[model samples]
Target: AAMDIRTLTDDLSVTGQITQDQLAQIAAQGFRAIICNRPDGEEPGQPSFAQIEEAARAAGIAARYLPVTGADLTDDKAAAFAGLLNTLPGPVLAYCRSGMRSATLSSLAQANQDHPAA
Candidate 1:
């Protein structure tokens, strides 16, 4: 499948689900890290986070798993996503089932970062 990666910021991009085989291509794209937002077993034939993490490790790319369904995107989850974005080497690529969840999380993270509550 085409990567279909969409850049959300200089440091971050979002994409639909990816397979382990795609790690090399992702690394070649200059991304230093990956975040998997899709949960394991969400769909049949989907690669588990463990599988992706291992592949990423071999490819010399950092990996993080912050799985969430659309309804599970609470403020705390967004905060956690922000933490990952801040600490993970960039540019980072975050992916979920169709990319929408990842994009939504990225936007929430940015908004919270820009306007922290007093």
Candidate 2:
């Protein structure tokens, strides 16, 4: 399974689900952090959040889990996503089951912000 990273901003990119082996490639890409938007057990045969997080930590990449079902993207969740984007060290990579959740959250968080406007 190839992890295709799609850049949404200089500091952020979104991608479909990735495997533990891909964490090293992400780190090699110079991404300082990873933001996961998929929930554990949401899909069958998916890696648990703990597995991914541990792999990220071992590779020296910061990791965050902000699961959103995409059925409803509440302001609070979007706000939390924004906060992570603001605080996480730059060049972050976000991923979800299909990448839509990650992309949606990134856009919502960027709304009315100066980061992408500049």
Each prediction's TM-score against the native? 0.98, 0.92
Clashes of 2: 0
For candidate 1, write residues 1-118 as lDDT tens digits. Answer: 9989999999999999999999999999999999999999998999999999999999999999999998998778899999998899999999999999999998888888889978
Write down the TM-score for model 1: 0.98
lDDT of 2: 0.89
The segments of candidate 2 whose C-alpha lies over 4 angstroms from its true place after superposition are 112-118
Worst 10 residues of 2 by lDDT: 109-118
- Cα lDDT over the full model 1: 0.95
Per-residue accuracy of model 2 over 16-106 as CA lDDT, tens digit each: 9988989999999899999989999987989988999999999999999999997868767788999999999989999999899999988
Model 1 CA lDDT for position 18: 94
> How accurate locally, in lDDT, is each candidate?
0.95, 0.89
